[model samples]
Target: MELQDHIMHGVFHSNGFGHLLCLNGLEAVAGSNLSGRQIMNFWDHLCNALRARKVSLNDISTKRGMELRLMHGIAYKAPWFGSWGYKFSRGSYGVIQPMYEKAIDTLRAMPLCILVHYLGSSNHDIPIIFSRYQMLSDHSLTTLGDMFQFMLELKTRMAEENLLDSYTGPGMFVEQSCRWSPKRIEMATRAIVEALKRADFRWVSRQEVRDAARIYIGDTGLLDFVLKSLGNHMVGNYLVRRCLNPVTKVLEYCLEDVSNIVPTQDPKVKTTIHQYRMSKSQLMKDMLYLYKHILKDYPSSLNVGILSVVPTAVRIILDAKYFAKEYHEDQHQARVEIGSEDKLSVYCTIMLRNNNINIEGTTTTLPPLLPPFECVRLRRSATFNELMVEVEKIFRDLYWGMKNLILDSVANLEANGKDLVFGQVEVGGKVIFQGSNKGGIGEEMMYYEGGSNWNKVVVCGCGAREDDGERMVSCDICEVWQHTKCVGIPHHQPTPQIFLCKRCENEIVTLPAFP
Candidate 1:
């Protein structure tokens, strides 16, 4: 019978209460027995309606329409919607009729055979139905077993089309399928191993390995499986290290030979080692340059006596044995002994006496000293790069220590109203301090006088020292010096006698005036 005829007969012949009653009371008999062909025709029509966008699955299952009410039974098994003889009194019937609503409900309670019939059919709309399986299952329209069948069929179809390799579907589905395929795991592992072997024992990112092996490892678990497979001693004796890629900053793997200390062909590792060594060597060269420049005769255009003490102060701090012990104790805790601090104080006193520079009543505190390592022992398996880093750290600490010592001595002499002077003694061609002489002592000697003070200078507005060779002018109000160029004053112009700094001018403008 035509669908419209069934709806007309069911709607018009029903009771006055608006409940649908089929013609000749056939609803009771029809609900008891639903045929497979009738169910297939209903699903086919629903699929066609869905494809044309005339009705959505949500509208069919949720709206109060006799034609689409059966979908609630099929999709959700809603008790009120699925109950026999329940009347849906709204929404016009689109494709389904009122008579078949009972039949569709009966089909909904049947076994999975009806689904098999629909899926196995040669209908062109089956693929569209397959795509909506997730949508159907999401609404509880299909069972777990139904979803399993859908996946199997979809995978089989993809394999038949030679599109499985290029299929970029959900990763969970691929992983589940791969998990059950032992042969695929083995092949992927072999490919990854070959890729690593070609990498020449260097670090490689996972994406790099994927491209090199031409195998898609979409998830970490699969890659982990391949790594575990490589760990088998029978496969290869590879030492695997998981480190961050220096360039990309991503986690990567380095598979190397167990016996090899370093990858000889890896330029990055070699370059890093060379950089560390060059840094250490450059630091040593700088230290020597500082010593030689300080001991050399000054240009007579600069302060020689104040600057000459810098090398001597550095030498005195470097020669202190207590400083060396402190550095060794800092690096190795097991070597620390009781009363170490007290012993360090005693050694400081001895070092001061040995230098013969007395600071009896002055505020000249000693600067903290860092030790340069006199001896270093490396393990047989340690790489040269590691040794270079350790040595570099030691030299860096010593360099900064020497710098701090020189600055501390100069500051103390300035604070105590004393000027630095060269002393009169020479030991091993390096001048040693006994006491200050009027005609000036040798270059390496350091002395301080009780009554001498150097000229006091203030920093300029350009954050440079007074001796920086920039032409400067002093503000008349605050007396703070500032560079002429920094204040927009032309160099060739004569200095203004009543110059005021920007800060003092702003302060004067901000002050309250008398009425």
Candidate 2:
């Protein structure tokens, strides 16, 4: 590629996915610029250009070489950049001005045009190495809490750079899909580990270190955002301080990995568990509890994508060191919790308000969700009530949304071979399952569907083997069942062949105790 094309490539790459990956150490070593192969070519071009000046160099991989690249915002306005640096401006990066002017002046005298041109062409972002968190000037990663602080600070910088709220698409939180590339992950991982080596945990206890690592490993992005961004949580000061307290702990639940619970193990072996539940219900509870309390005083935070953000946060807690392999039977729970949030967060958020009759500020008793086409007369200081309407509307949409999933799932099943049986009983003044299956295999709904997507959901409550066969049976009529074993039948008793769910069984003879 021509020099300009080369530069533009570097520039465009850095400003896009390059920068994000750089944040996570996912992109090339220096902000999103060139790959190793491309870097070598660019290096050679610079070396050849500077050869006559006797500034011989092997490559730009050296520490000094990088400083030149990182400082390109100032360094590149030098000789033989051939006015290209001034004449053309594209996506760009900036380095803070240094204390010494003469040092830069001396660099300007060198025939470093090729180097300058390369950096100017690619608007590469550099990884932020020097930050306030480095303990006592030890050039290393700080404590986990401090690491969060640094990330939050970096987020502010990203916002300033116009990277943070720039939309990529619907439901996409960040540009480049908010996923770091493999190479960038490796780079970030190495950097973090190496920096972590510099940390001194002498003042900290083992449990603290473990919890810190747990939170980070589970949901690094969410933890960082919550800690650094949300200052003074609802009625509580700085969310991190509130959550970090084990005494005032919020998201706590003992998760039992009951998926593999055999009748034999249920009697003999002692079961181990983690505080975070793998079940979707528990995940929803944890999330709702946290957001409800923390965002109460700052409800505007709820105005953001609660669905996307809540589950992400919950996943981090689940993935933490607290819940290792012992707590996860098939790792399917992880996928379910992450995926189901779009359906869950809507109703879950509104369900919490069922107890509070009035908005703290207004006399208006909360009303049902307003229709999108419907308008309500606004009163002064009715912000709290308006927020209530939004919550209600979201709950209405989501509650029905959960109902629709069963319909879609049943519709697809009927076309293929079956349908879901709607349970007659409602729980806690609300319909728990849209389809009637009082006692299913697990508490999990049998399937999920939207448009072209549909699949059976294996319930963990039923103690069916992991995608393996203990032989799950569905109702032949409506085909809305999965029973590997009877809920109360003795193991010594012979298992039946043709069977139906209680709702389905009602069509036939007397119903056996529902599984």
Candidate 3:
């Protein structure tokens, strides 16, 4: 049947403007079997009336008549109109929210197959159907599934063109409204919800969806609410760190904080804070440039800033530990020895100095070592083994570089020492470094690696096994590479790194874990 005939058929016979009520009445009251005889009798009466008025089918099918009839029906069933006229007149694609609520509440809303019968047919009016669907944005699943297929295809195309990060799904949904016919808002909502179920698609919250719809629908209330909510929070830190590369929407939130962040009294801290502000100030320009790149088919040019804002924020959170630990541990020290070859070993001594960490007990024993004959003889022209020893030193140097940075920060805070005299035991051979004080009264040679080097090695000192049968070094989540004792983990076996490693631990520490 022609589109106008189908529409008029409902208008003249259906109780409401929407075919939903007519379809429901036909099934519930009239019975399951709709006959050709009943339909022909109705059409004959309509034709006779038209003939008496000298009205032609061609005139009846004209756009104006169809529109008038549709409008008339809509006006008659105002409560069930679903704002069909306003939506079409305004050129919007989404269904009215109230209409959708009513449709879903129907005793027998149009079944999926009946509603979709002409969807794949060429004669189907795309604009009308699309508009109707938008109005039903939160409608039944069958309609939603079709939308999922379309959205995924569109997203894939955008990604292939490298514009995926520049525009969000809701943004695309709104833009598509420019050409499509009106649809129920519930239907659009349902379509979007289903679309997000696909892999690589993220379902936005209802509020976000509503906001997007309102933008096209010209509802300022949602926009006002969103802006107000964002304004109340201290989101500046999270924005810069979490979303280093933000989209325009995210940047709007960031800009909201421009007037709030200010320099602190600490000069060093102020410098850092100033640098952060400067970076944030330029974020909008950077985002626009990124958007242009994605839109212009330069996908490779679209970097992390275009697609993510999480990792950098993670880095900031990780870096904050350096300050918090400094505030709490004012005085703590361990005996560190700097070796010529660059290796560090730590020992806790028994000294309780009031102001600093002190290790006064001299009971810890050390064994003597002799330089290997290969090291002495192979120094001039090194063999393969000697080459490996040199290579090992290079790694040690790099480690010391990192370690020194950590130690220098806490260098001045050593505890007091108590004088402990111990009886000396017989030495077996030549010592690596012997102290001048034989009774251990004054000082002893402590094994320390890499003097003036920041890359110091500290172990967690987890004896061996870990708590959950997970190996220490293998844990990517915690990254606790040292033993429990080395890292100050006071456990017999390896405790879950969660207890000691900064990332896994509940509290912050001075160590930089991400690096």
- lDDT values, one for every candidate: 0.34, 0.26, 0.26
Ten-residue region with minimum lDDT total, candidate 1: 343-352
lDDT of 3 at 334: 17
The residue ranges of model 3 lying beyond 4 angstroms of the native Cα positions read 1-63, 67-70, 74-113, 122-124, 127-195, 198-515
Question: What lDDT tens digits, residue by residue, belong to model 2 across residues 1-515?
Answer: 33322222321111011110111111434354554335535533543343211111111121211222212312343211212221111110111122122233333332212222222222221101111112112122222223323333343343222423321101012224446443333232322322233336312332343345443356465334322322211110001111233665432211111122111122111122111112333223333332233222223333243222333332222111110011111232222332322321111122111211222354331222211111122222223234234444433443333232221111111222121111211111111111221222222222221211123333323333223223345556775435444344355665466665666667566655678
- lDDT, residue 181, candidate 1: 60
Best by TM-score: 1
- What tens-digit string does per-residue lDDT give for candidate 1 at 88-119? 22221111223234433443343332332332
Error of 1 at 315 (Å): 34
Give one digit per residue, the lDDT tens place, for model 3 in 227-276: 33222122211111012123343322121111212211243331221111
Score candidate 3 by lDDT.
0.26
Q: How many clashes (backbone N, Cα, C below 3 Å) per candidate?
A: 0, 20, 73
What is the Cα root-mean-square deviation between model 2 and the actual structure?
Answer: 31.3
Candidate 1: count the clashes.
0
Pairwise lDDT winner, candidates 1 and 3: 1
